[model samples]
Target chain A: MKRLTRMQIPYRVWMFLFIVIPTLILFVLALTNMNLYQIGAFDLTLDHFAIFSKNEIGIAFWNSFFYSSITTLICFLIGYPVAYYLSTLPNKTRKILVSLMIVPLWSNMLLRIVAWEKVFTADSYFTDLTGISLNLIGTQTAVVIGLVAMYLPFMIFPIFSVLEKMDRSLHEASKDLGATDFQTFVRVTFPLSSSGVISGVIMTMLPAMTSFVLPARLGLGTISLIGNVIESKFMKEVLGSSGMSINEGAVLSLFIMVLSVAAFMMITRVDKEGETLI
Target chain B: MKKRLWKTRAWKALGIVLMSITFLFLYTPIIVILTLSVNSSKRAYSFEQFTLQWYVDVFRDPSITGPIVNTISIAILSTIISTIVGTLFAIGIHSLQKKSRIRMMILNNVPVVNPDIVTGISLMIIFSLLSFTLGFTTVLFAHIFFSIPYVILNVMPRLKRLDPNMYEAALDLGCSRYEAMLKVILPNISTGIIAGGLMAFTMSIDDFVITYFTSGNEYMNVSTWLYAVLGRGQSFTPAAYAYNAMIFAITIAIILFINLKKEKKGKLA
Candidate 1:
């Protein structure tokens, strides 16, 4: 006990109080039939898991997964080339580009989504200017575009940093071996910087799967992603819904948690360090 | 060889074009928001004339002030607390022998790896268990809670890059562990600490998920305020448009400040 590092004590205490116990609370709340109104009335039941059967919940789950996956895929396709290009630029240009990408995150993201919402509306800014009805609002395309716009920076920076610091010697050696530029990229550069790619995907996908703001605003409150489902469960009790389904909310929470941790583990198996998470 | 040179040139042009489009896409939404804020008329999408009426309206609105105050205050407060505790935890976790270090790492990973929704509700459950009402205090704790792991993640790598021998050398020179850490280790990792604090600030400022669940209806941050208006199924007030403009202005100021400071540091090194 005396040998415990002094610094670890305070943090350990914090972890137990904030982290460990709360996790227990998640399982306990989910596994039990605890209603929101009567916190006291508790029964151990798996009824919360029954949300999986409802087609709406299932569709929402699938929608969240699909949107996030597509968002991630699109980000990579666009972001990788940008990152790769930035990596090849001079230091000053690279720094400017990278910082330019990141600075948007500090501003209000909701406002940005709201801006997209307006642009996609029936009388869009585009339509107002050009007098054409694109009619994109409330569409999946709007949600996807909103998400991709918001999350692209997150995807770019990690890959850029990784590629910037890559071993130039390896690339030179591959070229010396008579490898073409495309071959060198495919065999050497992509494989080496995959850690960054993995980190980018994980970062983008997690928030993408869990974001309610993009779906709600961009979809005009019509889309029902899993995040919207979870949010509605919480948002409804306050907005005048009976029986908050706090237990069912917990069930969905646990499900998301399980999916996320599994994704992390699977990603980590390929990339143990995943050093570019930020 | 000429053909190959032309081909490479073409590819470079294509990549640049794609990159430009990406940058354009990234910048366009925020630019539109900022441009729309100063419109002469609220309903008019065109720039028929410019007006600061929205700005005046935002300055006069009572609800805007509370949310602005709450958002900035929460961001600053949580950044301070999380940076301190998270830096110490990074040091402590790094100092430990292997077995317990792995355990601590896994625990530290929870807040990072867990979806914000899970973290929010779980924290919600605990706060409820402790009979703490959902309000400013719970929101503070929630922000601090999530921000710490972020700080830890940022600082841990810096700590890992430090040479263990430096600490031993300080101890051999008769310094206490605390003193050695302060004099030798802290200087090396201050950059990481600063970066982590910046990230924490950025995250806390932008946060809506955890803050939404944990903050009672009364304690409104910038995000929750915006969300509340959106939830009512109405577009933002013209005043809210002005507020978004202010946020963009602050973001630009921050970017310039960080860049100048980084340049100064680079020159020094």
Candidate 2:
């Protein structure tokens, strides 16, 4: 075992350099006045904290929470029944159905966003094929639709896996003890599957909350989440603009990171091995 | 009792209906892309006619081919490196005491859970901090950095299932430690390794965010390239649709082929 442990030293170094060091840099940049352009001399200041005072920041936060909550709620509504249905199928059918569900994921996500963008625009292929021009571009509804399409699988898989692994006799016992079907689900099945539900919510909500591209494309530049704010800030830095510095981006990133790390902790508590993460 | 049974059947029917709707939601955009790929229309906004010219154009167009080559190469390179390195790391982590192993597992899950924007920014800061040139090498490193965790995630469960005494048994039967590992352990965990490798490949290929930030000005993968042209109004090619459609087709083909092979093998056994 000791000899085997030696193999991880290289990986540890890799993680230290990549993960640990970068995280520390993110914290340092977020806390200080260090600019990406002027990396030499800088003093610690709470100046970046002023970003939170901006209207865009406030709206970004609201939009992030609003969109993510709606998306997660919708996914749970749609996904829970889908997962339960899949769980009831025979083994071979379930396997085939689940794989088919996952196949869309193997395709490029950006392209799917682009596809949705095309559909939302007036005079789209959808209109051409079905004579129904949605013209839904630049709307929150379009963004949410794209999000649900993108992340529905993330919700369904966790719940389905947990439900499948559950002891069926529990449900049988609940029914035998004079429980109604809905009562059995409410009291026994749903409670037992809470961990999977948590995993699913975290998985769906985190991505929806922090997503940049999905909103950028599907929202048609009308919507702004915390992700877009962070992206534009970094883009400004990359494009050689000192205004809206990378420190501001770092602060925003750290803020988002805090939320994500909390969610990750919740997942770790429920799923010790992260079996449902994929 | 009859009324309760009727309600149960109604619920089941509703489930099937919702499943059908969800499946349509998932597949509609894909079907759109597939349709637009063969459409004779130059504009993706509206379909003009059905034709295979865009598929032909995908081959002739330099813009599409260049990014496709970059995406594939980076995906292949990162997948190979991450798969091998991550398998070893999983073995090493699995060798640890339970307390430390859980800590390591949590640490490994960081990249998995962190939003891509943050990961991208953090890596960008690190590369800039170290003064490493941000290009293909930096992008490859970034991919591998994020990818190894997934590989570890996939392989760890397989490692937990392996019999710990098998290695010792192999050693006692005249195999060297390295030989024991190669002959005994790696073979047992080959499926996980392959699955992890496949997963790493898929992630690397589809990645846009991290690659966007890390690739700098000189390089662009398919995703970043699509993004760059997305705002350019008319220069965006329908060939992109063709390209995505082709990749979708190939993936479905590969999966179907693999399933057929597996079923044939199962029948043979």
- List fnat, each candidate: 0.52, 0.64
Instruction: Specify the highest-DockQ model's number.
Output: 2
Candidate 2 local distance difference test against the native:
0.87
lDDT of 1 by residue, A85-170 (tens): 88888888877777787766665777777777667777666555546555688999989988888888888888887898898999
Tell how far residue A118 is off in model 2, in angstroms.
2.1
How far off is residue B35 in model 1, in Å?
A: 1.3
Q: Lowest summed-lDDT stretch of 10 residues in model 1 chain A?
A: A266-275
Q: B126-191 in candidate 2: lDDT tens per residue?
A: 899888889999999999989999999889989989999988899889999899889999999988
Please give the DockQ score of every candidate, comma-separated. 0.54, 0.72
